[model samples]
Target: EQGHEERKSGTLSEPQEFHSGFIRINPDHPDRVLHQDIDNIENIRSFISAARAAAFSKPVIAIKTGKTAAGALAAEIHTGGKQSSDAVYDALFQRAGMLRVSDLTELFAATQTLAMHPKLLKVEQLTILTNGGGPGVMAVDSLLQSSGKLAQLSEETRAALNKVIPQSDMTSNPVDIFGDSVPARYQQALEILLHAKEVKNLLIIHTPSALAPSEDYALIIAQTLDKLPKMARPYVITNFMGEDAAYAARRLCSNYGIPTYRTPEGAVRAFMHLVSYRRNQKHLTQTPESNADDAKINKHAAKALVNEFLAEQQSYLSTHQASQILAHYGVECIQTEVAYTPTEAKEQAIELGFPVALKLISPSIPSKSEVGGVVLNLNDAQEVEQTAFAMLLRIKNTYPDAIIEGFSLQKMAPRAGANELRIAVKTEPNFGPVILLGEAGTGLEFAQAAVALPPLNMNLAKYLIAAAHDKGVLKERVLPEKVDKYRLCALLTRISQLVIDQPDITSLELNPILASNGQFLVLDATMTLSRYQVQSHRKRLSIRPYPIELVKQVTLKNNTLATLRPIKPEDEQAHQEFDQSLSKEDRYKRFFGELPQFNHDQLAKMTQIDYDREMAFIITQDNATLGVSRVLMDPDKIHAEFAIVVRSNCQGLGLGSLLMRAAIEYCQSQSVQFIEGITLPENTGMIELARKLGFKISRDFEEGSINMVLALTPIDKHG
Candidate 1:
């Protein structure tokens, strides 16, 4: 509990200041209780949640040791804490917005670098300024490994740099300022690079030189940064390449608020940390596109099928059964027919019109091709009958008691220039439902699969697709027409919705989902079932899904019908329009000052909220948002600060009260202790509304604001 407080408070303490947190886990130790009493998965998640609390957006680095079998054995013996798959840990860290490092060195490097420059907000290319060619090359290699870009020096910057360095080659990025160059040369080149729009990030590598101490070059760089205004200075990192000779120089740069590394690789790794941190922060608030088809989803039909399967004690659904479940959710699959015997198989293939593919169905045989249980392109009924009989005989000879349930036949998918892809859903012991996508082939492994947690919106689905493309799981091809990415993303989003809506689905796979001629068809699909006992489907997810249950229809004082529900990312435009309709005085009362239109990021931050720790209730009449009330919960989940606003024209119609009541009800349900807010003293209408809501109101003379506090649940001081 104490460790939890520290992790939560690490950034919450002084949110105005950037605080980078690091955690190192060593399962092997002399004292078992000291380093070992943790459920690796859950505790790691708790730590990540605390670090990623909406109150702060700082980089958190984690180092989990004991990844190998030998280390796992030691961990098990020492702490009785079993190890989990390292890949799962990697995916969790990535999805949860934490940076996972291999060791203390990387953890420290990332934490220190991010701590020094916490506002490094972009993923711009890096420009390396080095005294040695070898170290510069090493930096370039590490940069690419980290998925970083190397900046190309503009001709203008390069020309200016050439005048100072006097070497044509030295003017380019990784601008090799000759080893024996004077210290002022570093300052001159830095000034020119700082002005260049291309040089967003700068890495200076200074190896030991006989002509001048590394300290002099470091001093010059430090003095140059100190003289410039903080905002005018470009992002900078330094690598002083020796232990003793460079220690003082490294220390000097650190004192000037510049990050320094012992090696170029270390510096590049640190830069990537910042890059990942910024990108992850944006993803944290990414608004998923609202699916209009959500209303069309036949969740009941899918649920009834799952119930029937479970009641029949059938864990794995038959090919046809799985296809029906998918059809309920609008996932397209190649039509297939099942046959219980060789005669039936031939008849079914004939009915389907041949040029068909026949696959064996058995719980024991996961891969039909490996057991000679799959035959394709059978042109005639005779060939189909013969192939089916041969496949049954071959499987029976290999395994005497193999359960040969039957065979399934589908029209052969067109294969010329088409791409086969796989999308699957599996239940992870800790992370719950995980969605996977990859190139379809024999023996697919999770290590090679692109993973994303479920309840994905279109935006989140796009991110998953992007990750798949980056990992080479999804490829771009000109043949058979380029894959319709929009359609593919929509399919993925629907698949995710299927997983989210059906808790009984323990596993699902759409393998060899043929993508050709601008169409995506699921060639083969399998689904496994389990009893759904969890009270809420959202509980099964690491990330909370949207709260559809919170949506309610209410009539205001004037009998104006409106919907009071949680706001969605898709409401950004409507939200903006609502804000603009507010009178200046009403806006001031809400925002505490005259407000301008919000930019995309600010609006995204407002609409794309984390449902786990926050709630925003927007009251809408027809399709227009009338008012919104939102509350941001603290780390402890005890106190929440709220803000409420209503359209000026809609005022006095009870929209504010309706929205506020909805927010309070949500807080009370979440067991939040207090919901508080501050308003200008001049806003008597809001003050009266708060008072009527049973809040204890007080005036703060110093700030000239009214404080409204409502204690929904009392705290247990003794407990």
Candidate 2:
């Protein structure tokens, strides 16, 4: 409607609209232009996420449709198979740093917000200015509904606002200016709110009133907002109530590049788009530690466990077989064994100690508790035998068609009031495996589950755990010590890797995964397999997992055997320690200044990088931090920045040259046009290293740094 009005008034600047969702900026063009349309979405993400790994000056914004049940069905009908291929498209979009907006209103608001204050993506604080109590209340409710917090004014700020508005009216988040408030009152309130150092962003609201000069007040706020310095300005979103009369004011605000919304609720929702976008950008920059250890995953053993069940022509593995599978992957489960006879059950119970559980194993009866086929806490041999026999008799009469094999015996492991969790891997028709971690038990709530498409690493696993716990999905039981999160993250990574390796596994369930004391034990489980397998296993995951194939062991020039591999998420601590070991001078050469201790966010950004567009290689022997090399690719994936540092002790062993060669080769493979770095003029050692590697040396006096570039591959001549 706004565009039509602008077009009618001869002020429409942007005259293009696109059906193609993906966008790009080509240097060959005069300006940005549409290049391609999605003809097919067979491998949806390959196209949906084509721009995810590329480096861009601005964020890649996306619109995801079909999140609702009716919309999903329509999409499936239109697309011919899936409403969406990946169940976790939202997750995929987030990992790629794409800002996903719900509707056109949000798309416009969020774009304007980011355009005005790109740095505010991660800022969460908000302050409000309103002229009416009812509108102020609505604005506060909307912000809270979007999971946003209202910035509390300091005592000094409150006192200042109290002087302008009445004390009774000013004692709140939305410093409510009275209904009869004039332009001066709006001006004073905005000044007080914007200057409060606690404020990260500001929302100015106006509802139509008899005394309130809605249009005049908006122009006043706009002019005041325009005078603020761009560098320090918080993202300001305005809500000028009603339409026709407010159109000119809205246009005036838009002319100044300030975002104005139709409703307060829309404005808050739009602000959250910036919130979610920046949070995801943080997620993108944070991939430094891959947390991938090839030594941890034994593929041979995992395959062997799966094949045994296939050999027996069993589609579903029983609790005993399921426990064996988890055991191979280093996931602890209750010790379980199958007993063929009553005497065998008694012997198994005595061997496992008192208070063991006996469950009747059958093909048809999936849940033992349903058919009276489970016996828990059998204290003695006689009781075990009696319970085992009774369970078999009960299952035999009730489930006549069930193929009863034997009684499965497992120790009744106690959790001692630890958090009981449900971890399951379910497959989609085309998208492959999605892992769900949430509250456990038969009476599970849908709202309490958090889902992610895996292959997961320690960092991603840690994110899932924290998100679930924070959102009230994963709860803690009464326990003195909490469930150790590190161990849980490691275990989750293992489970994710296992599913990635075994393609035929249809579904897996580990209910009541008792988590406590840095240990996890699966109390009960069921794993089903299928003859059908995904053709391309790599495409199974929506987000690519850690690339374990890049890990290698090399002998340094000093004859020291060292492991040279891509940096993992767990390398944050090692990277920090490596930074601390550097001398003040060395740090100046590398970081270009004296360095303070690296904080968690800073260290995470340095270590945790998205493996898609960049690579970091570390050389370590006996887990000691020896040296590190990193190459960060531009959004275009063409230009790259290469940096290397070998600890002072390990210098002059040809390690620095070896790392440079590796980084160059890696960049060439990634189709990077050139690799470059800046060094202090006095850093002769680094300058010499660049010369030996056939790089062109130049001095950027303006930047006060020596610049070097090594072109690996030439650009395409045809274009």
Candidate 3:
């Protein structure tokens, strides 16, 4: 059971549970266990749900390998076609907040580190503690290799370290305590490292030596960590050298929740997982600005275009048709007209004045540039007709099998910036529709693109657009204004939404996307649709998008019209004001204590919720937050803790009742078994509200609180 032993257990090995988990990273266990029940979907769902529930206590990682011919056969024979596509698995893991790694080494290291310090979210730098110089250098090399940073010792920290270990022999970042070290000396260094603000992670490396206090060294570190407060303790991992001298030391470290790796590389890699976790979680909560109208798409018009193309038995859209689709969704595209004859090409080219481009549009040829099917800078009608005739002859000679539909006459748009970018939505065999951002065309062959999942909001869209910034292509802005990053981000978000709305679309590409003075336009596009209906058991998307469909209007008992919708990331500022507007008494009634005001971190947590298992609905009259109803679901998916609060002025206006009904309906729809909450015993209004909402109310004398429980449905146990 390599890397299978639970880090929480003190022992080296424990009795392995056959139903331990879906450990996809384990290649040693090569045999794929085939569950016999083919149609027992409930059984599989219950099992997966339970596994996800366990993962909530810590991060869970999985790697799905073997998608080739032989591997697919093994999978099909094992599961009897019960295995949903890997895209569904990605969505499932995202909903669970599980980190999906690509290798076994990463899986074990990340799992061990997270288990040791669940609250250790991010690592800016590491305070390395070591005995020998060689081992110290090894630790530093590993950390830097994993993209880890070394904390610079402040003057005060340097002075303290000098006092603990003589400055003559000390290294800067690694803070070497010399080859012959004692437990007392290590403790002194530990005190200085822990108090230093520059360090967020700690790595201790010690090579086996007769002079080293091997057993006492681990014991001292453990005892010191036990005394420090939870928040004060940084992420700590130790490399205790050899098996002979480090056995007892390893046990002591494990017992105290310290991850002990046998090698420096392993320890540093484990710490990097903490860094990755922090970065990913922060991105998840970031709420960038976006207009409400930005998401509004012409669904009817887009659908009609797709229907027309499919009716003609065409699997792919022409450049003209693709541009039309982009226009319907408010995306700017180069003007294009399909020219049937050389005369038609001359006519459209004349209307464009000058500097037009001609592209051969064919059902069989998706990439026209590949076969010299495009010609630019046709300044006059004569050139347009001449190039159009030559283009037809060349296509016949070069690509004889390519079905030449018609030639597209497009206006040659000028550029604001010299750079050309490509944005695409291509279905991956494993991750479903992945957004690709890079330098468009043949240039992107060697230059890697930034890839992300679909259903992106503004924040994620920004992340994808800025992906090429590190490659030095984005900085060469020739225009007076810098690249309109927000506009570019909005474009990616629109494309993401388009793909989510249209599942039959297998691939969409926008090559040589031009951006000038904050304006963006697509020069060319090609899209393909699936011929047969997709028959995966999973939905089109794993990550749930913004619930615009969930928005509803309701008239209160006072005849006051109120609109309710799921909370958005942009609601952080409004939420802060809502908190301040609450009276002291009302705050105590709602939060179980006085919350004078929510800090920035508190505000972000309330605004940016992972909508898969959590949801908050707010009622507004005129864009002001009037009341909020929220639910925090248990990982089990059966139980949820729900609460609602209305503004003091809005109370007693039937707002609370409306919110309560919505919460119950939401819980029932999600298959939540029950909802429960606790409030102060003195809060009679809440007790009355609960009783009216069909909740069983009871007083807890021991805790001096009122308990309310509402059973929505029964859990379906696997039979």
Candidate 4:
């Protein structure tokens, strides 16, 4: 009875009622009878498992209260002791993939946010609008607290907002009106923010004080938001006032598909979560690259280990065995041969290579660096012998009881660029193997890189490499002459695939993945494993040919026509023609104004099409092409870039939009998330056409161009 009443009072009957969905759980139990009726631990576990299965698409959030031991004991009367029950529950919830809320306020905000913006691309990049400075300040503070960024207002956005507000108002971070604003003013501000280039999500904060009536402002705000493209923008309204004002605002906002919260903090957190979820979803849908060789290596090693260990009933392989596995998977480790004596170490160095690194390889002592058992850079036979003797004596003196495996002599790798990277893996109970990439060397512990759970396919591997600071550094700076970025990217991709295929790898460290003197090498490596560990869910790798479908074709005036087909690698010639036709000014606008010379490598990357993420079509008349339109999907395939170039003779024929419309239809048919295009502000014709096509256009001062975004969802079927 106690549990039943609590469930009836707290839980929603139909959690998936809305198109955008959310799952809510209330931890507060008022009825005491429920505590004595059921086995709490067993019941909670069952409920958590069921909820996880039910809310796979929606975000299931659990809100728990009561922290005191007395309360815990009361709960334990039906469940078990506090410690065991809490631990089990925590693990259960985490395993079941439910997001736990710290407070009731957060829970409510999360529910509304999820309900309003269920799709990932619909959230993130928020715009803030407020009437008074006090509320504006509070909104900004709340946004920062929730990790929501203040979007930079575009020039057109500023001009539009200025038309409504006084010239003295701040136009950048927060659009604030000095005095009481009318419905027109609120609507104008919201419109400007919604159409801005930088703003994807919006937060509207208004205080229902004596200055302006709360109900009127709420009605206007709601109406304005409803007019916006359903997939392009999402908004949250906050009313700081009496209960009547809050209720009015919430009702109006909800009616217009805008989420409403009483507090700014809750609204901001909801927006942040929405953006994060969208980013993760994009990562999930990215097409994985093929790394079949790495998979084969892992398969062979796993099979070999199973056969070798079966007779002896051994669970784990030794370092040598693990090294062989890694070598097969393309991980470059040190070249070392076990040496029994100092003379043997000298001979081994001579036999292997010059300038070798000598390290104590003892099965008993796992961490050689901690035990002063490592010696590096021995140039000659005499030096190798001396270093080997010194390392052995130091290790023996440090730990007399430690068993010795012969000295490992490895070739000393040259220093590379400043960036040293580490990719480590640890097994999680439910998420399986979690891969962590970070800065290596002395300050490695401080510079934490990106993390992902396996199966590590091509797309995830690319993301991990891109997520690191090294990739950023490479992008910003000029690479050394003759440096190969593509090769490095490929190597990282191979390493990630290897780790995913080989889960027996407990700890794998590759310090100083160096790019030195136009060459890349793994300077050092150490791998460890748990003897009896078994990976439960092994994901299979597969590759299939890209799918193709015939989309709409367009015909322009003067009989210039184009049959839009899926882009392919063989179309590099057509891609070159489009690139060559671009005027310097047009090229500058498209590439952020840098007139860098293009090479074969650059052209390949720019023109490469992954049908899942990007597509480009050519306009041909009698096999003589006039123009081409390219659509490149953004990182989160939710947004795509539309760039078109036509031959100079065909400029005024409306061919661009025809090609653009074709691209838009293709995007819609493929279920592509969103579409974005950039045109110079001076190109009035293009801007007008974009607006006519229902694209939300914004002019940016920084880029000296107009940005247009079109949401492909709810696509006009006839168009």
lDDT tens readout by residue for model 2, 1-719: 22211211111122122212232332332222112211124553344344444313344555556667787777677657654432366555655566666665555555555555445343687788787778888888988876778887788888888888865556578878877887787788788777777776888888876764567877887788778887676678888888887777777777767778878887787677667766776666544233345567676787887887788788888778887777767877787888999889999889889888888877677666767777788899999998878877777788777888888888888766677888888776555677878877663333456766676777678878866866678877677878788888888888887886777788888877887777788888888987654454236555555566667788888787888777867778888888888888788888898879789877776666556546888888887778888998765667899999888777888778878887887888777888999899999999999999999999998988999998887433210
Give the number of the best model, judged by TM-score.
1
TM-score of 2: 0.77
Q: What TM-score does candidate 1 get on C-alpha atoms? A: 0.88
What would you estimate as the lDDT of candidate 4? 0.57
The residue pairs in collision within model 1 are none
TM-score of each: 0.88, 0.77, 0.78, 0.56
State the C-alpha lDDT per candidate.
0.76, 0.71, 0.70, 0.57
Give one digit per residue, the lDDT tens place, for model 4 in 280-307: 4344233333353434355566546645
lDDT of 3 by residue, 1-719 (tens): 11333333111111122123432213233222111111112232233433343333344455554334576467667545534444344333443444566566665566566655555355568888888788788878887876668888788888878887876447488988987767788889987887788767789887776765577888888888888897777767888888877887887787776788888877777777777556544554643222324555786688788877778877887667888777777788888888888889999888877899998888777678877788888899999998889988888888788888888888888763445778877765424566777766743321356665666777777765654564443455565656677877777777877776677778888887887767777888888887436544444453456777668999987898989888888888988888988989989999888666889877887887656557799998887899999997765567889899999988888888888887777887778889998989877887899999899998899988999999996433210
Off by over 4 Å in 1: 1-39, 43-49, 69-84, 167-170, 287-292, 477-480, 535-538, 556-560, 593-599, 634-640, 673-681, 691-719
Q: Write the per-residue lDDT of candidate 1 for residues 23-90, one digit (tens) a residue.
A: 22222311111111122443433444444552134555556666787876776676555565555666
Best by lDDT: 1
Clashing pairs in 3: 416-516
lDDT score of residue 524 within candidate 3: 86
